[model samples]
Target: MELDNIDFQILWLLTENSRIQWKDLGEQIHMTGQAVGNRIKKLEDNGVIKAYSLIVDEMKVGLSYTAFILIYMKTSNHNSFIQFINEQNEVVEAHRISGEGCYHLKVKIHSQEKLNLFLNEILEYGNYSVSLSINEIKQRNPLIATI
Candidate 1:
């Protein structure tokens, strides 16, 4: 879909704060609340807006550790490994990538013990490397850059 300046403006506002009221958004963009709602609905229908989410502190939720695991798998076992990873709740994101490892996983766990247990479980499949994030420098959706 061809997204014009208004659509980009709507998205920019939403990206900054998804919970912003339609009336406030309208005021920011010189439109009525109903018009803002209509534009958002159109964006949703076109799949431009995929999902609404809240950014929560993992530490507050008892998940304090965030680990990146790189896995090197045996050939012909990709699907089985993917299925195994999919069943693991601690795995927030996984990607098959090019380079040294076949897959990379982003996981959050309550403690080091849980992280160890998860690492031990995956070791049965193949070799892997784990790195814990000390701090997050920056994170943002690329859609905002398009604006």
Candidate 2:
């Protein structure tokens, strides 16, 4: 979709806070609330705005571990493995990757025991190297950079 300057502004502002009121957003850009709402509706209809999400503090929620797994599949057929990851709650994000591994997974779990159990399950489909996050330095909405 061809996005105008106002559309980019709307996306950039919404990226910072999805719950921002249309009236407030319009005030910043010199547009009426109805106009902004119409634009947002079009953006959503076009799949430009897929979904709104909340950024949760995992530590506070008892999700104590975050790990990235680089997967090397042992089996040639990967359909079952793809389905496995999709069904796993701890697997927050999984990407079919290039350069080194077949897939990269971002996972979160409550404890070391849970993490170990998850990895053991992964061994059924693939060998994986995991890196546990020590600390998060920065997290930002990607739309901010694009704008």
Candidate 3:
């Protein structure tokens, strides 16, 4: 669990390109491929590296609309609402927060009509305020930021 400079370097390289071969990564960091693999496996086992992700172009994939929804619950019970969010494929990211709302949701849909339908479905659980994103300026890599 204690990460040294080498581990940080490996994390930084992995964040830049997760699919890079272990040997190539080792070459960059001056280590053997097998050693790098052992470190990576350790990271995974320790829950430092949770999962590998793919970044897709949403527009090209027909997911043109990105909406941020702030949900204000009508009732104290949240299980039903949580289940609804879990079942909705459009709800890409969901977080429970303390502030102006009970929950925050990041949603992606293909069209305005679908967005409208999604919003209507949400009314069953709570009232929501929606904001549409015109552009994404930056997607921060936490490893790069920390290292």
Candidate 4:
């Protein structure tokens, strides 16, 4: 959908804090609360606003290990592999990619034992390269500029 500057501003505001009241958002963009609400509803109806999510601290939840698993699956086993990954709650994100791997998965587990078990299970499908994340340098809301 074609988004005007107000729509973009609304999206930007929502990206930063989804729970922001319509009155507050309207003040930021110089629109009425009702107008802001209507726009947000329209955005949702059009599927522009897919989901509202919380960015949880994995460490606080005892899931300190963050691993990226690059998967290589047999061409014929694509569907089965996809199903397998979908059923795994430990997998936070999965992406079908190009270049060296068939899929890349971002997973989080509470312990190394769980990580090892998860890895061993996937090895039955094909080769994989796993890396543990040491630190996160930067994370930004895609809707806004760094400055």
lDDT, model 2, position 85: 95
lDDT of 4 by residue, 1-147 (tens): 878889988998888899999999999989999999999999999998999988898899899899999998856558888899999999989999999989999998999999999999998888899999999889888678721
Report the C-alpha lDDT of model 3 over 1-147, residue by residue, as the tens digit.
689999999999999899999999999999999999999999999999999998998889999999999999999999999999999999999999999999999999999999999999999999999999999998898688789
How high is each candidate's TM-score?
Answer: 0.92, 0.97, 0.96, 0.94
**lDDT agreement with native, every candidate:** 0.93, 0.95, 0.95, 0.90
Q: Which parts of model 3 are misplaced by more than 4 Å?
A: none
Worst 10 residues of 3 by lDDT: 137-146
TM-score order, best first, reads: 2, 3, 4, 1
Which prediction has more favorable lDDT, 1 or 2? 2
**If ranked by lDDT, best first, what sequence of candidates would result?**
3, 2, 1, 4
Residues 1-147 of candidate 1 have per-residue lDDT tens digits of 899999999999998999999999999999999999999999999998999988998888898999999999867558888999999999999999998999999999999999999999898788899999999899878987788
Residue 66's lDDT in candidate 2: 93
lDDT of 4: 0.90
Q: Which regions of candidate 4 deviate over 4 angstroms?
A: 145-147
Residue 139 of model 3 has an lDDT of 85
Q: What does the lDDT read for residue 92 in candidate 1?
A: 95
- Name model 2 segments beyond 4 Å from true: none
Candidate 4, after superposition: displacement of residue 8 in Å?
A: 0.8
> Lowest summed lDDT over 10 consecutive residues: which window, candidate 1?
73-82
